[model samples]
Target chain A: MKSMASTSDKILDIAQSLIVAGGYNGFSYADIADAIGIRKASIHHHFPAKAELVAVLVDRYTKQAAAGLQSLREQAASPADQLQLYIDYWRSCIENASQPFCVCAMLASEMQMLPDEVALRVRTHFRNLAAWLTSVLRAGVEQGLFRLDKRPDEQAQMLMASVHGAMLSARALGDPGLFMAIVAPEIARLRDT
Target chain B: MKSMASTSDKILDIAQSLIVAGGYNGFSYADIADAIGIRKASIHHHFPAKAELVAVLVDRYTKQAAAGLQSLREQAASPADQLQLYIDYWRSCIENASQPFCVCAMLASEMQMLPDEVALRVRTHFRNLAAWLTSVLRAGVEQGLFRLDKRPDEQAQMLMASVHGAMLSARALGDPGLFMAIVAPEIARLRDT
Candidate 1:
């Protein structure tokens, strides 16, 4: 029974990887079963349907990402540092190939194709990240650690868009260094006197 | 014979619209044929396969986009004006709903699912746009119209990435105004001494 539980976990991990590489329609349970050396029936037993599988994946990814952001927030001395830490984390991810593609980014690209539940989850993820970022920027401004002429929410949206755009550029150019190049100045522009 | 040409052109036009709304795999020949008041067999007769249809679409989009950019270059009095003209064109597209989504933006989102030829064409579009923007930035710097701390190529990439990123954000947020808000400041920043 324990082994079966491990197998289910394995299936979810593989599915996330495939989904990040492609979009929702890019793979199927049969592909997951083949990749994991499990029977098609076994995948059905675990996930039941594609929508359910992606919903769970989005849920898991959002939770994990939120926790990660929380940890970053706790570790940084200031909101500016927190923002740097966030961008730096993504830079490392790109440089080390730890996560060649961001899960949220991949899902955002396929927003039109995703089920409503899955799309809602993806939308929630964006809102959560942007809100966290807005708070961080607001704190930075209050503490005189950052400068911005626009509202925190607008700046946060711009920053988020730039980050996602950098990911697409990196993927298109096949060079991770470009990611840092695209993001560094945006971060630098936030430094306050 | 002319009517036959018009029918084929109509299919391509509808196909582009559907593909923009959805991704590459979002629609079918039947959908295009139905929208065009034709038979599925007619679509098949024009393109024979989805891959071929998309390939042709990508090619035509790239060519037309390049021509549009060239026209912007020819009509503008300066490089700065040219860049603003480019942004203004996209802004109008977003505002008037002429083209709410860029073909390359849609294709970039589906790169993982696209065939090699289609993917190459998409990449080429990015490369061409980046190269043109770089040349414009370089000219602006020389003409004392713009100031930048980075190489023209890098800055151009940043600008292009920001534009694409803004599109994703605007689409996800269901607010076309957000697109202008994200990009206008970036353009203003470049014009700032």
Candidate 2:
């Protein structure tokens, strides 16, 4: 059972990199087999089909991301700090050339082509992330740490959108600095008391 | 000559829709041929190859978008208004379902898979758009019409990112209302002076 679990994780790591590099439709089991040095039949034995493979990939990504955010929430002193930490995490990811693609961002871009099960997971991830952000923003507003002309939920959506957009802009320009430049003000805006 | 121009435009139209529906590698000449009721040979006759087709598409898209922005700049009374008009144009495009996929957004999502020429064009589009946005934001700040903690260039990038992010969020959720909801406050924030 342990061996099976490890293999599953290995498959997921490969899938994440492939999806990030191309997209949902740009990869196939043969490509994964080549990268992992496994038979196509073995990939099928684990995932059964492309949709199932992506569905599991999305699920795992959302789960890991949620845990990371939860940890930040527990460790950070305030909502504003948590927000900065989140942006900083993305900045580091881009800067290191590791995890250059956000799983949700990649899924969001291929929303139309994704299977319904995969697409639903992507939508759910956004909703949960947005909800958590809304809660944090509301807490900040209550503590007099953040200013807002709108509701927390609305502001949360805006913040998320800006982050994703910055990722796209930065990647397009081939400059991680561009991503930082775009998101820095947003972080500053949240820091503004 | 006019007939050739119209055929080229048709090819672009089909390509854009396919890219939006999938991504850079989503479609082929066969798909475009079927959509436009043309022969595969004809598509090759016009485009020579997939890379050339997308390169021309991106080039033409940037030109038309630039012209649209220039016209908006000439018509608007203030930089803030100009920026708002720019957002409004995207809003209208999304709302009317006229152009559901932003060409740059689509390209950005598949940047890794794109050929060098197409990738260069995508990068140029982003730089041009960001520069235009920076100028508008600078004018607005100078006019005392917008309040921003960061420099205009930085703020503009943030705004651009947020707008694009909102589009992705909205599309992922399959809700146009969500897109507007996310961008409205960012726009309102600029107006808060």
Candidate 3:
């Protein structure tokens, strides 16, 4: 049982990275096999189809994102600080090339080709992230820590779009610094009041 | 010769749509063949390789984008109006499901998997766009019609990221309205000053 769980975790990690680096069709089972040094049959045993594997991968990502937000909420003293931490986390990811961009956002750009189940999982992630962002922005607004010309949800959508878009620009321009340069000011603007 | 040119143009059109709908590796020569009612061998005659096909596609897209921005510059009266029309172009694309999202941005997310030539073309598009946007923003600032916290080039990066990012959110959320809802505020903020 322990070995099975570990194998499953390993598979998800590989899939997540592949999806992040490319898109839905960018990597194949053979690619995964080569990377993990495992036979194709073993992968089949874990995930019957590519869709099943991707569906699970997206679900896992959604949960991890939510958990990260939850931990930030618990650890931070203010909503503004929580938002800053979130930006910093993504900034570090972009800078180190540890995770160049958001997997959900990457998948989101390729939504048309994703399996229906996997696509739904990706949408669920955006919704959940938007909700979390709105919650933080709303709290900040009510607490008089942030100013808004629109609703929290609207601001969340804008900020989410900017963050993901900044990653694209940074990767495309081959300049990791561009991500923070684009995003930090926007986050600061939210609290400029 | 004319027919051959027309066929080549048709292939690029279909390939661009497929790339927008999915990513770099999403479509195949067979898919293009099916779309244009041509044989794979014929597609081979035109493109010869997937990388070559995509390279030409990216090049064509870059030119079209540059042309679009150019026309807007000549026709629009003010820098702010030029920016508004730019946002409106993307918003209309998203609303009508025409272009929907920027193909260069889509390809940017899948940069690591792209052929070197194709990836370079994608990067070229970004650089050209940033240059055009910076030009517009600088004109706006000089005209005293807009305000920016960063240099025009940096502001251009933020605005470009936000525009492309909004498209991702709108698509992921299955709501095209989200595009304008997110972008309008940022644009308005620029002109608000």
Candidate 4:
């Protein structure tokens, strides 16, 4: 049972990296088989289909992200710190070349081409992220840690788009520094406001 | 000569939509042929290879965008108006579902999977765009139409990321209004500052 779980975990890991590097349609089961040194049939035994594989991967990713955000809420003393920590987390990821781009963001780019299940999961991830961001911004506004020209919901969505857009820009330009260059000002603007 | 040019144009148009719908690896000659009522052999004759085809498409898209931006510069009276026009252009695109997304922005999502020729063009599109944005912001600053916390270039990158990122968020959440919701505030902040 443990071995079976490990194989599934390995498949999900590879799928995520593949999805991040390219997109939903970018990689295939053959690519995963090659990376994992397993036969195509073994992967089928676990995932059964590509859409199902990615759907599961997105579900897991969404849960992981939700937990991370929840922990952020606990660990960060203020809403401003929460926002800073969130940006710093992605900053380090891009700088280190580890999980550089958000898998959901990459998948979102190919939203029209994704399977219904996979697409649905991607939407859920964004929805969840937006909600968490809204909460933080709302908290920040309530506590006087942040100022916004828009309502908290609107501000949260704007910040979310800026972060994801920065990721795409950094990846598109092949310059990791581009991420911070694009995002730091956004955080600074919020503080100055 | 005219007929051949039209066929090539049709092929490029179909390929653009397909790439926007999916990614670099999302479609093929067969898909284009099926869409255009032509043979795969014919698409091959026109494009020769997918990389060359998309590379050519990005080039055309860059030219078209540059022309549009140039027109915006001439038509709008000020940098603030230029920025407003830019946002309005994308706003209508999303609202009408005509040219709903930027082709280069979509290709940027699949950058790692793209061929060298195609990837190079995508990067060029971004650099050219960044330059145009920077110029607009610089003009705005000089004219006292806008205030920015960062340098013009940095603020330009931030705005570009926000626009592109808002597109992603709108598409991911299946809400087109989300585009304006996310971007209007960014623009408003610039003006308010």
Q: What TM-score does model 2 achieve against the real structure?
A: 0.94
- Candidate 1 lDDT over B93-142, as tens digits, reads 88886777788777776676688878888888889999999999999999
TM-score of each: 0.91, 0.94, 0.96, 0.96
Fraction of native contacts, model 4: 0.94
- Candidate 3 recovers what fraction of true contacts? 0.96
Off by over 4 Å in 1: A1-5, A96-98, B1-5
Candidate 1: residue B63 lDDT (0-100):
91
Model 4: per-residue Cα lDDT at residue B108: 90
Q: Write the per-residue lDDT of candidate 2 for residues B15-114, one digit (tens) a residue.
A: 9988877888888899999988989999998899899999999998999988988888899999878987888877888887777768878888788888
Residue A60's lDDT within candidate 2 is 90
Q: Candidate 1 clashing pairs?
A: none
Scored by CA lDDT, what does every candidate get?
A: 0.84, 0.85, 0.91, 0.91
Where's the lowest-lDDT run of ten residues in candidate 1 chain A?
Answer: A1-10
lDDT of 2: 0.85
Tens-digit lDDT string for candidate 1 (A95-139): 886676778667776676678888888888888998999999999
How well is each residue in A16-118 modelled by candidate 3, as lDDT tens digits? 8998999889888888888889998899999999999999999888888999999999999999999999999998898889889899998899888788998
User: What DockQ does each prediction reach against the true complex?
Assistant: 0.57, 0.81, 0.90, 0.88
